[model samples]
Target: MPHAVKTFRPALGAGSVLLLVVAYLVVALNARFWGVVFDTTGLAGLHGAKVVAAVAAALFALTLLMLLPLSLRWTFRPGLAVVLLLSAAAAFFIGDYGAVIDRHALASVYATDAREAGEWLSLRMLAFIAAFGALPAALLWWVRIDWRSAPRELWSRLKLSALAFALLAVAAGVAGKDVASLLRNRMELRHIANPFALLAANLSYLDHARDADRPFVRIGTDARRGDVLVPSKRPVVLVLAIGESLRAASLDLNGYTRDTDVDLHPLPIVNFGRVDSCGTNTATSLPCMFSDLGRAAYDDAEAKHRENLVDVIQRAGYEVLWIDNNTGSKGLAARAKELSAAEGADPSRCNADGCHDEVLVDRLKTLLPTIRRDTVIVVHLLGSHGPAYHARYPAGFAVFQPECRTNELQTCSDAQLRNTYDNSVLYTTHVLAEIVSLLGEPSALVNRMPIEALRCRARRGHAGAGACPEPDVSPTAAVDPGIDAAMLFVSDHGESLGENGLYLHGAPYAIAPDEQTHVPMLLWASDRFAARRRLDLDCVRRGADRPLSHDHFFHSVLALADVRTAARKPALDLFAGCAPSR
Candidate 1:
């Protein structure tokens, strides 16, 4: 018979538990912070020692602010467990992804859907959570606490708090100057500090949530169509393709060494080589770019309450449709007919990582022939969203060799990551090419034109002898282009491909790298659309290299559809600079 094994359970007082958790958080969960500290201040001499002491004191002060107060019998273990898990998650994202847990980043996190969030789950992430979060939480739950008399416990806690404050004061006094200098020079350090950054983000979220029931302000209600001629006799159809996380520096059209835009090379696309994005991440940029308020005046908290460009265009008598292939359109499509790519996406183009951008192309192809009015279709593409870049495109589109196939970005080599990212961009270009072909060649569209378009043709007397031809649903059917269309492609923001130790976007706007803010913008319009809008392609091409930003997006899009309003700023319209001579 096996002898019964003796169980060993450790008992710790409330103060001791607090100390253990504080120590774990400061040491184990603060690797990214310590790494930054060492990088900024080496392990030698007086200045380094002063900085290290200051940072250590600051970390202790901040961590103790929460732990010291809650280190009581009823709240101690559960509180520590929450702190451990939260800090562990914060540490993982900060250390692995070089992500900052700030307001904008938290906003993106809140907006991310379950499918996109699943891309972040990996074996390493799970193991990290287990070792640092779950294991400590388990021990905290199992270990017995030695409770003292209420009066004694309160007195002991006060004494401990007094001691901690005294130590903190001493440390601050000794290294206050160095701390100030460090903080002034490296402000991002605060954002990388675990638990504090997370706490700060949550606090900001709470503050923003207070305005959840604020009154909605409608702008551009007085919007109307301008005196733009309709010489083409076909209704205008504009496709606004909002690209996701594509940097201008990586596009062949912008002089990138790789032929990422090879498929779009033959098209008469005006590539704005130097375009600044409103924000480094989608949550900030998507809404900001769509708002009438430019970058400097844009406030995320107040944006939802105000009407955006889409609403104004819709009010201007254009039928609006929003097709999202990525995440939902951040409430921009609330007033429009929104179609998700997943609803009718081709199974051949989908996988565990979700469907490729080709699904959007397929959706657009089917929607092209159905245009019967002045319409604006917004196509939100999942372009080059990381870290599973390898799954973003089809196998044939992965021309770059040796891709990083996993979502664990740190495990991949620089080349592998770049290859995978470039492949996604290439695939995006292919989708754009398919769209351009669909819009440029009217044969594909006119052959399958709806009966409504035929009726319009009959009304215009375009049908021979006033007898409209029955719609030919054949691919080889020859017919005049039935619609005047245009396409504008602009990435929501850019990405950081391991540049300067930053892997992905979401840096604060103040210190965001060029790679994270410089996005690609392209415009392609059919001959009829250009002529009707009085747009000169050659003139637009001459200013292709001019400096531009998302500030121009609102007015430019309005100009595309000739939507005029008191809110529309003519000075901000890029196409107006190339308007045809009267």
Candidate 2:
């Protein structure tokens, strides 16, 4: 008889497998954590090694101890696979975009719609996940485990847990004070602690999810339409245009060297130069922007239970409408008339990636002629959101050459990123210009004005028949106005274009750079609206450089529409103290 063929099969003890996984997770999936550690501790000498070694030891022990509970015979491999996959996804964002895996960041992830999330899909991301997540998991599932009896396995796990605890104690004892100080100073490092950060974020999300069925609290219930101080026959209209990812530093109106705001150069829009966002991402900023609770007091869990700005304005008897081209209104429009531009988006303006912001202009065109009441139209734009910046605008809007079209932002050159981003900013301005021109049209106004003749009178400084000039406050320019309409544009948040190795937003708010917080805001009121409201255009211009924030948004819109409520704080309203123009 022929000798039986021998085959080799890899096998390891359960403890050995656990150790291998722990080591791999800490060392392989945590490049950002280690990089921050080395950067903060300075890898120059023995001191660096000491600090790094202590952190490594503590992290290792904590990870092993935490994971030990799930390292049983039936649960070990599956749990490990799950961890690897999650860690891989976290690592990709942390490494490539310099994003943190904190609760707010996780909230942004959870709130992201499929179209927005798909903007992040790329071959590089796929390859990274496959190499770091799926491959290891496949290998882990394939390996054979030398399992002992149940009692012996239980005792072995307990012994391993004990060992991990002892190691953790030793690590804490040796350099606890120094490590604590380091972490306190660099709190962001905590957010990059792989698996731990992910685990903590998920736990926080679950904790908040428990309140999903809680009773919804109502606010501004005393809201009612107040007597118009400067009465007019026509209805009041306020267009609240919430912009997305538009940094103040990138706009020409805010002194950007580029011509990103060229389209708005002729328009009489008040550019608030020193504006700050409440948060670095839309998930955090959107709710805070509309909530009565200011940024300092804004808690996602608490805010979800209360009514927002839209609900209050709607309750005040204004015909509130939310037209969304980005994502949904984040529950702000729960009680308002809502329209989605992306639902039946115009093919000329939309593609597989998403719809252009001009789709908003199209919606406004249809809705403009029909408004016959005091209205608050919220135009939520998908403005300059990345890393698919190139897809935001039309091909004609690609004036900036060599744009970065790929989702892999880090793969692009600095110029390409800025060019693509600037192009988007330009297109946004163009959209704003279009909206302004539309608002100035005779058909859109309640009482028809010779808007074309006015444009002609101001044509010395502008080219097109539709381009508007600066506010004509000349005594001779005064006349009785009919329609009361205005536009307020404020971004949800800002973006980071490879500044200080950060490619996207959603760093912890405390440590977020200016590029992620300093957003652009501007106001453009129709001539009649300004005149009827007795708005001191010059005074408004004088205060344009005031240090403003999202705190002003809620009260300002309310004040503009003459909505009176106990909840409205006059102190936070931007138009609070403007005297009537002479």
Each prediction's Cα RMSD? 9.1, 5.5
TM-score leader = 2
Off by over 4 Å in 1: 1-6, 41-44, 229-232, 441-480, 580-582
Off by over 4 Å in 2: 1-7, 41-43, 229-233, 441-482, 579-582
Candidate 2: lDDT of 353?
83
TM-score of each: 0.90, 0.91
Local distance difference test scores for all models: 0.82, 0.82
Residue pairs with backbone atoms closer than 3 Å in model 2 (clashes): none
Error of 2 at 168 (Å): 2.1
Ten residues in sequence with the least summed lDDT for candidate 2 = 441-450
Against the true structure, candidate 1 reaches a TM-score of 0.90
